[model samples]
Target: MTCSPPAAPGPPEPPEDAAVTTETVTEPVSTPRERRGWYFYDWAASAYNTTVTTVFLGPYLTSIAEKAAGCAEEGQTCADLHPLGIPVAPGSFFAYALSLSVFAQVLVLPIVGAYADRSWHKKRLLAWLTAFGAGTTLAMLFVTGDRYLLGGALLVVSNILFGAAETVYYSYLPQISDPDERDAVSSRGWAIGYLGGGLLLLFNVIAVLAGDSLGWSTAEIARWSIVSAGAWWAVFAVYAIRPLRDRPPVETSRSRSVFYAFNQLGRTLRELGSLRLTLFFLIAYLVYNDGIQTVITLSATYATEELKLEQTALVPTILMIQFLAFGGALLLGAVARRIGAWKAVLASLVLWAVVLVAAYFVPARAPLQFVALGAAIGLVLGGSQALSRSLFSQLIPAGKEAEYYGIYQISDRGTSWLGPLLFGLAYQLTDSYRISIVSLIVFFVVGFFLLLAVPMRRAILAAGNEPPRLL
Candidate 1:
């Protein structure tokens, strides 16, 4: 972690945002210890993303669901499981579970954020959510045999908890860092997350590869890997939350009223009209981030099905991307310091567009070409996302950070469905993964043009925030 002398003792003067909220303004003092704690939280949480969400749970869940559907073996194609008289494909079970989780997050996280903002116990809320989420994840160890229903329920609950926790977690960004420090701080957090997640994934990969020799079955390996992630998250989060101190509540009134929080949530939604540039930026983020997420989600499938790359090649590529992305996040932050976060994000978008186009042309049976494409993807992935978060933090009203971020998180989670839908449609029509992959370009193109129309400095000022030093 970067070191600095202690922050000057005393609250700084409130900014223009004080006029926008009814709460007493307690100016935040950014400190190295708090920032380090914040970074560790990112590190602690990312194991869920890398190990369970991205790597293991989907296929493992599918296999269990297949067995429940009466498949003779895990790898064989099986009949759909009919739940409540509705036929559900085993292959799509994890996808559906993820969708359900995101849906739950859409309904719940705004209220979570709103309550967090009003309460004096933000740190406690984060801790509770993390513990519960980790507990649910750890429960996967008991989802043995054909207990597909239990697995699905646990996955949904855990994922929703993760998103809710993340909303509370992200609210800390604006509170812990000044405008000028946000980009670098956010970037470093993402980089550390990549490092933490990568190291665990590497260990899991080694365990999986050595499973047969170690007398462990594939199922055993997957189960242990998942539980390891939960343990890692729970263990690391202790240190992550320790050095952090809670801010003064945004308001002491309505501290006990969910209805009041929801009303404030509605007001926040209506207030977006006046924060036009912030709204526009959210729209742009929703579109482009969908494309980015779709690409990340579909890469393994495309490489395996389209290019016929084996797990031997595919797994290593994922590991490479994870590690490289650490440096990539830092590289983007450094670039942001020189050229500003806005331009840096735009540049990353252009890179994303290029990566997709290049993916469309990758030759069949070409592992080398696929690995090279993944390297390019690794370079832009975390950088673009980290910078986007920092940039959006600069565009929201100060005391209302959690309220505005509630909307931002909703957009982040809720809008990712479109790109995948479009991708599926393209593949259905063309019978080609290449065509399906390129179809996502529409998202980036439209988002880029929409973002160009946004006046960044004006939006920051309009939100009653001073523009960041670089911007």
Candidate 2:
């Protein structure tokens, strides 16, 4: 999702010998069309976030691995398989695959962000990754019975691109919204995403629920769902690629060499101490966002393995989360206007802690309880995430929004790998998803106190922006 505005026509530059010069000028306010176009990518990208990442792919891929490993039926005990000489419970395959994808992102995305900030073609870069990722997602239709490796490989590549593109997408936030308007704009994008994700998920849920009567196997239905998400992502992405303006490189001369980009990055790293308050906030966000993301990525898997919910119940339960998340994001944005975005975020984090504790005790046989848990989670999911990005924007230096956002994106998507990896390891050791989930509470607890301690006014002033108006 490219949030930066397109280059509008400017008055022609004066000839070198002309006595007068014209300065390139930009509109002070974003037009409605530009705002809508900015929101489109979030709307489009959410399909994959919901259908492939959050709901279907992990559980479905695990089933494929289980079948390949000769496991049959629910309640049958399957021996741990070591496909690559490493012990792996059948349930852990998809989670581990997710962790692997995050690991790749942690290594690649920083450089990608640095380069994207220096490239004149942010729109093209965003489009290339979107198409590449979406194509890989569509290829999941071919990952049948014993093709777990193909599924895993495709997921790794697509998910990495997803994170990489997001680095560019998120950096555009400050470019579009004024400080006072950012929370609302970011929340709107998130809410729109949930709406789009929910619509596609609604279709997938129906397909899964009706598969038996239609003479299609459950696996067949899931593969189709994955492909649909890709189609949704590709089709909606065009709105962003075509309408939103492309930004010139943040620093034109910096774009001249690959080494120059990293050289600048090295200088930024050396200056981290000057931005220590923002550093504190980043750490706090890193921990808590990890918990939030871990729950999101693995919720369906947890419900399937621990709650024993059927696909019919599980998929619809996820659909419920999607709708609720849309409302929740918008609600928090409104509430943040009254209570301050920082306090609103703190409130959401507390609710997250409540959700984790409540999830641990939800009885496996009670389908209604699982549905309720999904609702509670949806309420805080988008609120916390949307606000976090906006709040971080306030702390970044002017003219270096994209450069600093590279580090912020590192916290956003780069940190995603650690949570899944830790979650996977916990499951590998305990074979209890309940225990693994509850362990994530430590991150939330730590992040809360750290956030409470950050000097907001100081951070804003340090970044050379006025302190945000809480009301």
Error of 1 at 115 (Å): 0.6
Residue pairs with clashing backbones, model 2 = 5-245, 6-245, 6-246
**What TM-score does candidate 2 reach?**
0.91
TM of each candidate vs. truth: 0.88, 0.91
Best by lDDT: 2
The best candidate by TM-score is 2
Worst 10 residues of 1 by lDDT: 1-10
Name the regions of candidate 2 deviating beyond 4 angstroms. Answer: 1-28, 254-259, 411-415
- Estimate every model's Cα lDDT from 0 to 1: 0.79, 0.80
Candidate 1 clashing pairs, residues 3+ apart or interchain: none
Tens-digit per-residue lDDT, 1-471, candidate 2: 232332223235434212121111111256678788778888888898899989888888999888767785776777776767887877888878887887777556766776776676777888998999899989988998778888889988988888877777887787778888899999999999899999999988888878888898877888899999999999999886677666554344524465776777777666666788888888888888888888898888898888888888989998999999999999999999998899999999899999999999999878999899999988988888999989998887654656676776654632376777777888888989999888888878988998999887788888767677882
Task: Give the TM-score (vs. native) of candidate 1.
Answer: 0.88
Model 1 Cα lDDT, one tens digit per residue, 71-161: 8463566677876676776655655666666667676778888888877778898999999999999999999999998998998888878
